[model samples]
Target chain A: MKKYVKKAFIDTLPIMAGYIVLGIGFGVVLKSAGYGLGWALAMSVFIFAGSMQYAMVGLLTGGASFLTIAITTFLVNARHLFYGMSMIEKYKDAGARKPYLIFALSDETYSLVCNSDEGRDYYLLVSMFDQIYWIIGSVIGSLLGAIIPFNTEGIDFSLTALFIVVYTDQWLNTKNHVSAIIGIVASVVCLVLCGSDKFLIPAMISIMVLLFVMKKFCIKEEE
Target chain B: MNWYAVIAIAISALVTVSLRAVPFVAFRGNKQLPAFVDYLGKTLPYAIMGMLVIFCLKSTSFALTRGWAPQLIAGALVVVTYVWKKSTILSIVAGTACYMVLIQIVFR
Candidate 1:
C-alpha cells in the first residue's frame, strides 16, 4: 500500500505538470469571464474536464441553453463510453475506492492509468493525485488571474500543447504503429469530409472498426 | 449558460463516476470479468487513443495549416521523429519548430 501511494505520486508528476499550465489558463479565462475564484475552484473540483471546462467559459458568458450544454458535453465527452468500457475489469476490483476512480476519470488520469505498469494498484493513486493537482492549479490560477493582469492571448495553446505531448508519448511507447497511423489517416479524412462541426464521431467510428478488423485479420494470420 | 454549465458539470461528473464505479461495486470481491466484456476491455485503449489523437490535431492552430505543403512537411517530421526514437517533448518541439520554420519563415 505504501509503495502504491508512492508510485501513484510519481506517475502523477507529468499530469500535474500539464495540469498546472492548463488549469492556470482555465483559471485566467474563467476569471476574465467574470467568474470569481470560488467558481473556478468549484468548477475544478466538480467539472474537472479540461477542454470542456475551457468551453464552459463560452457557455457561461453567452447564456446558452441547458439542453444545448448537455448535448454538447455528451458529444465532447462521448469517447468516455469507450474508455469506461475498457476499464470495467480494472475498476471491478477497486472495492471502496471504486466510486472515486470513476469520478476522477479525466483524460490525464485515464492516460496515466492506461499507460501505467500493469497489475499495480497505481491507478487509484494516480487518480487521486491527478485530481488534487488539477484542483490546486485551478484555484491558484483563478486567484492569480484576479490579482495579476498579464495578457492571456495565447494561453489556449497550452491545452493543445498538452494533448500533443500525451499523443506523442503514446505514439512513442506503442510497439505497433498500425493503430497510430490508422488514427491519423481516419481522423484527417473525416475532418475533410465532415468539417469540424461533426468530424469526431464519424472518425472515431471508422477508426474503431478499422482497428477491430486489423486485430481479427492480423491475429488470425499470425496464428 | 452559466447556470446550465454549472449544472452540467455537476451532473456529468456524477454520471461518469457512476459508470466507472458500477463494475467495481458489482464485482468488489471478484477478479474476473465475463469473457466478451473482458476481450472488449483489452482492446478499448487503442480505440480511445485513436480518437484522442484525432481530437488533438483538430484543435491545433490554423497558423500551422497555411497550405498542404507545410502541414505535410511537419506531419512527416513528427511521424519520423516519433517512430525513429520515442520522445514526447522532442516530437512536439520538432513538430512545432518545423511548422514555425515552414509557415512563418520559409513560406512567408
Candidate 2:
C-alpha cells in the first residue's frame, strides 16, 4: 500500500505543478467575479472538471440559462466519452473503488493511468492525490487572490499552452494524420461559422462525423 | 449561492459524470464494444487534443488592431521548442512565460 501510494505520488508530480497553477487561475477568476472561497471549494470538489470549471466562471458571470450551461458542459466534456471508452477494460475489475475512479477521471489523470503499468490500487491513489492537489491549490489561490495585487490579464492562457504542448507531443508521436487534420479543419470551420461562443458543440459533432466517414471510406480504399 | 448558480453546477456535474460513466455502464457483463467504437477510442484522443488547441485560441482575433501577434509568436515558439526538445514541462512553461511576458510587458 505504501509503495503504491508513493509511486502514484511520484507519477503525479508533473500534474501537481500544472494543476496548482491552473487551479490558482480558476480560483483567482472566481474571486474576481465576486465568488469566495466556499464557492471555489464546492466547485472543485463537486464539479471537479478543470476545463468546465473555467468555462463555468464565464457562464456564472454571464448569468446563462440552465439549459445553456448543461449543453455547454456536455460539449466541453464530450471528450471524456472517449476517455471512458478507452479505460473500460482496465477499470472493469477495479472492485469497489471503480465508482470513484470513474468520477475522478480528469484528462491528466486519464493520460497518466492510460500510459502507466501500475495496478488498480496505484491508479486510485493517483486519482485521489491529483484531486487533493487541485482542491488545495484552489483554496490557496482564492486566499491569495484576496491579498495579492499582481497582474493576471492573460494568465488563463496557461490552459491553452498546456493543450498546445499536448497536441504537439501527440502529433509527433502518431503516424496517422487523418484524425488530427480532421480535428483542426472541423474546429476551424465551426469557429468561423458558429463563432467562439457557439463553436464547441458544432466542432465536436463535426469531428465525430468526419472521423466516422474517413474511417469508412479511407480505410476501405487502403484495403 | 443563487438558484441559477446551484442549478448550473448540478447540471454540469451530472452531465460530466454521465459522460465519464457511459462506457463503464454500457460495457458491463462481458459485453463487447463494436469495432467502430473501439476505433474511435483509439483515434479520438489525437483529434480531441487538436480540437482543444483550436478551442484555446478561440479568443484570439485575427484582426490587426486586436493584436494577436504575441499569442501567435509565443505559440510558434512553444511548437518549435516541443518539437526540438520533446519536454512537456519545459515547453509548457516556456510558452506560458513567453505569453505572460508578452501580454504584460511587450504587448501592453
Candidate 3:
C-alpha cells in the first residue's frame, strides 16, 4: 500500500503542474461566466475532463437541453470509446474498483495509468491521486476566482496550452510519427472539407480508419 | 445556485465518477489483458491527443487561415522539439514561447 501510494504521488508530479494552470483557467472562466466558485468546484470535481469541462460552461450557459449536453459530451468524449476499449482486458476483474478507474480515465490519468509499469491496483491508485490533483487545483482555483477582482482575460487558453503539451509529449515518446501525422492531416482535411460543426466526429473516424489501415498494411510491411 | 443546476451538476459528476470507477472494479484480479485490448491501449493515447489538438485549434478565436497560422506552426514546432528531446517541460515552454513571439511579431 505504501509503495502504491508512492507510485501514485510520483506519477502525479507533472500532472499537478498541468492541473494548477488548467484548473485556474477553468475557475477564471466559470467566474467570468457568473457561476461563482461553487460551480467551478462542482465542475472540477465531477466533470473532470479538462477540455470538455471548459466547453461545458458554454453548454450550460447557452441553456442547452440535457439531451443536447449529453450528446455533446458523448461526441466530445467519444475518443473515450477507444480509451475504454483499450482498458477492457486489463480491467476485466478489478471487482468493486473497476468502475471508478474507468471514470477517472481523463487525458492525464489515462496517460499515466495506461503507461504504468506498476501493478494494476497501483495504476488505479495513481489515477486516483492524479484526480485528487485536479480536484485540489479546481477547488483552489474556484476559491481564488471568487476572491480575485480582475477580469481573467485570456485565461481559458490554458486548455490550448495543455493540448499542445499532450500532443508534443505523445510525438516525443512514440517510435514513429505515423499516427500523429495521420491525425493532423486527417483533422486539417476534415476541418477544411466538413467545417467546424461537422468536423470532429468525421476527423476522428477518418483518422481512426487511416491509422487502422496503415497499421495493417504499411507498418506491418516495414516490421 | 439554482436547485436544478446543482442537481444537474451532481448527476453529471455521478455519471462521470461511475465511468472512472468501472476499471477498478472490473479488473480486480486480472494480470494480463487480451491481444486486441492491448493494441488499443497503444493507440488510444495518440487518438486522444489528436482529438484534443483538433479541438483546440478549431475553438480558438483565431480565423483558421490567418490568425491561427502561427499557432499551427508553433504547435508543429513543439511536436518536433518533443520528438527530438523527449522533454515535456522543454517542449511546452518552447511551444508557448514560439506562439507568444509569433503573436507579438506577426499577428500583432
Specify the highest-TM-score model's number. Answer: 2
Order the candidates by TM-score, highest first — what do you get? 2, 1, 3
C-alpha lDDT of residue A188 in model 3: 79
Question: For residues A72-187, what per-residue lDDT tens digits would candidate 3 score against the true structure?
Answer: 66666665565676667565656677656777778667665555457678867877877777777776766676565644433333345556667666655566667667777888
Candidate 2 docking classification: medium
Q: Where is model 2 more than 4 Å wrong at Cα?
A: A1-14, A32-34, A54-69, A111-122, A216-223, B1-8, B65-67
Considering DockQ, which of the candidate structures 1 and 3 is the better prediction for this target?
3
DockQ of each: 0.33, 0.63, 0.37
Model 3 over residues B1-108: C-alpha lDDT tens digits? Answer: 477667666656655555455444454455665554465556656665766677667754464444667677777776687777876656666766676666666666
TM-score of chain B of each: 0.59, 0.82, 0.68
| Candidate with more favorable, higher DockQ: 2 or 3 | 2
Give the winner by lDDT. Answer: 2
Candidates by DockQ, descending order? 2, 3, 1
